[model samples]
Target chain A: MKHAFLDEYSGLQSPMHRLDPRAKLVGLVALVVICVSTPPDLYAAFAAYLGLELILVLISRLPWKHVLGRMLIVLPFILVVAVFLPFFNKGGGSYNLGPFTVSAHGLLVLWNVAIKSTVSVLAVILLSSTTPFPELLKGLEKLRVPRLLTTIMSFMYRYIFVLSDELQRMRRARDSRGWSGKWLWQAKVIGHMIAALFLRSYERGERVYAAMLARGYDGGLRTIYLYDFGAVELGFVALVTLFPLAARLLAVG
Target chain B: MHIPDGFLNSGVSIATGVVAAGAVGYGLYKAREELDEKSVPMLALCAAFVFAAQMLNFPVAGGTSGHFLGGILAAVLLGPWLGSLVIALVLLVQCLGFADGGLTALGANVFNMAVIGTILSYYFFYGIKALLPKSRTAFLAATGAVAWLSVMLASGAAAVELAVSGTTPLSVTLPAMLGVHAIIGVGEAVITVLVVGTVLAVRPDLVKTYGYQPPVPRFEEAEVNQ
Candidate 1:
């Protein structure tokens, strides 16, 4: 029922929140690319990347709990994919870790996936936590992202909450009806629920289109330009961009 | 699967990014003809539907749960062009709004799930459907089979990308990813079939690719065939 979680902290008046969305998008994505592109053995560069991310996090004033909580979503993936590396990789020669034999190559691969993915996810979380969803979409549109895609995304964002609420209601209704959904054949209930949602959404889309046309629907969606790429945004972008690059160069040297 | 930012090497990421960009661009161009002004909102709403449906988790074996991917399902409902775009939109939102996937790896994820997953499943469903006699069971059976195969193929693509990025060896990643997804795909197949079957029973016209109507000459039918 509550939808504030999408951009819960975005309204806060921190410097990270005040910066232009375009600046934040560009700068943070640059940080991610540089961080990911860095060599796996570049511990110094990884430290710098993580350090820069932390500084931004602090500057943004987002709760450590929220950031860490969001980071946990990727943990299962890391464990499933990377945790097996040390056991499977035997390229760099094997070393016994207690009773288990592990390879240096596998351990390095594990570290690479763990660190890179963590830092990258954090960068995105920072970007999103600081910028509201509408502003982020607007920023994307301004940054030469295709208008069609952005418009589609904007509409999708608007309705995710509505549909999810409906889904929750259906789940409650289903559970209240005493259907456990345990047996494999019971997947039919889930399927029917999805079908119902799809039909509701489709009909709603048509109604929305008709309403838009009644009020003169056009191919392009228009919004006021509330963003200014001034000196503050420039400096923020430069700091984010140059800090990671410098850290990477220093690591190489 | 949503690959995080750091797992893919620059080369693999860029290459997939290029391929994804090209495919998305092409999809947009083709989808334009079908999506006129009227259906734009419909497409958006369907995109939202897919995103929300994905959040609906179903029970799997041993008390485990697997959520819907909605790639092949969307393709079945809305043709490959618009379906790919819808799935890509969902992926982009998940990456940026939710941080479910990595920004740098967005292209790779899009390529695997949206492009390969959606388009591949579309053709597969059609190819299979054509082989069977015209019947409700045949249509749904084809949807279920293609949905299952689509997940395995997408995961296989992801494993290959991981191997190419030197994140994992092909031998290890291939069997491991596919082996796990093989079970997850059953859920995908079941859900996809039920949804498509329900929609077909209720409003067959809403299903873009459902050929339940008698053979009639329609402008859209020609486009669908191509």
Candidate 2:
């Protein structure tokens, strides 16, 4: 039951992996905001953003295949917008592509969604892949995110694999019982499975709580500090922030 | 209804972000005072349950499959405050961990799926259940209807966000989004009813909103069992 799909590459040794999670979180999120906010027509700015991302990827030493594969997650959303491209062609100038008459405005909209979503998704992937999930949660806690929420999230991350493995076993059992999920009535079986899963998870939760109490757990979860935001982290934050801002401004100017 | 980034303009993103932040912050604050020691672990496990349950994809019409949207289901099982918090945590994890949703659009996604999908739908469920008779049938029926409505509401909210972002006019995104979700909502309703009904039968006490009491065995039946 080894499901580390969320941050598979996080343990790899690299410059990106060494930075404080808080710095990476803030810097990468800022990059995403700036990248998404830039006008669709600013091709140069978009290129700069893309270039910055490429440089970071290279520096991080993440495999191109991993990054490219993750980029595919955004394709469904991009395709949804792309499908309506023709209908969006209103007053904006129209372009004839054989049988289809798509508007320039519609094309712009597609580009906007496609590029921005791709870039934003890439940033998130880089952040997640470079930083282990626990460290990232710690970063969030230090960065003023609510302690309660972070604690819950950490727990969720911890048990997600266990529950999902449980789900997989259930699915296998169902399939073995000739439950092809073809007929509409088969939904009842799935429902029962979900309910059973909930019950099992709830019981497990109770047991975990009991175990925690036995170990002198006093409601609040505590961990020793491992991250320090010193010169390197600050410089990384500044470089990420100012470079994107400069690209955006230069493009606007 | 996980909206990716760039689908919404910064204005819509920021506005929804503020609203989502405010609501989730309040939820966190309330949970501290409201949830007891055991509930902390319970809530976390429930969130994990949701993430896992959503992966259980069931078949729909026309050779297609649809997955469960467990917002109303969660709210029904665990009151609105914890329910919405669970959905929010799932969305956040999906956004960062899987890159399933965009970083910039996390706020909008949380607003749509967590806020509108869970909290608003729970109130709707309460109203609908009140109107219906207090039988298991009525309860399951109400769950189905509200589950459908929750999906519709969430998709409608997303369409509005897109329109407000000026990504596409409401004329286009609205009909399109609602049209697709209308089908998806049926799947949502069916699964929600079945899941809720199953839980109600096995462990009615676990259902916070349902409050269904299992029938007590008669003396004759108990004697026979013995």
Q: Which candidate number would show the highest lDDT if scored against the true structure?
A: 1
**Model 1: clashing residue pairs?**
none
Q: Quick one: best TM-score, which candidate?
A: 1
Per-residue error (Å), model 2, residue B14: 2.0
True contacts kept of each: 0.74, 0.75
Q: Quote the lDDT for A73 in model 2.
A: 88
- lDDT per residue for candidate 1 within B71-155, as digits (tens), equals 8899999888788888988888889977888988899999999888998778888899999998888888988999999999999
Runs off by more than 4 Å, candidate 2: A2-4, B212-226
State candidate 2's DockQ.
0.67
Whole-structure CA lDDT of model 1: 0.88
Choose the strongest candidate by DockQ.
2
At residue A146, candidate 2 shows an lDDT of: 78
> lDDT score, residue B83, model 2?
87
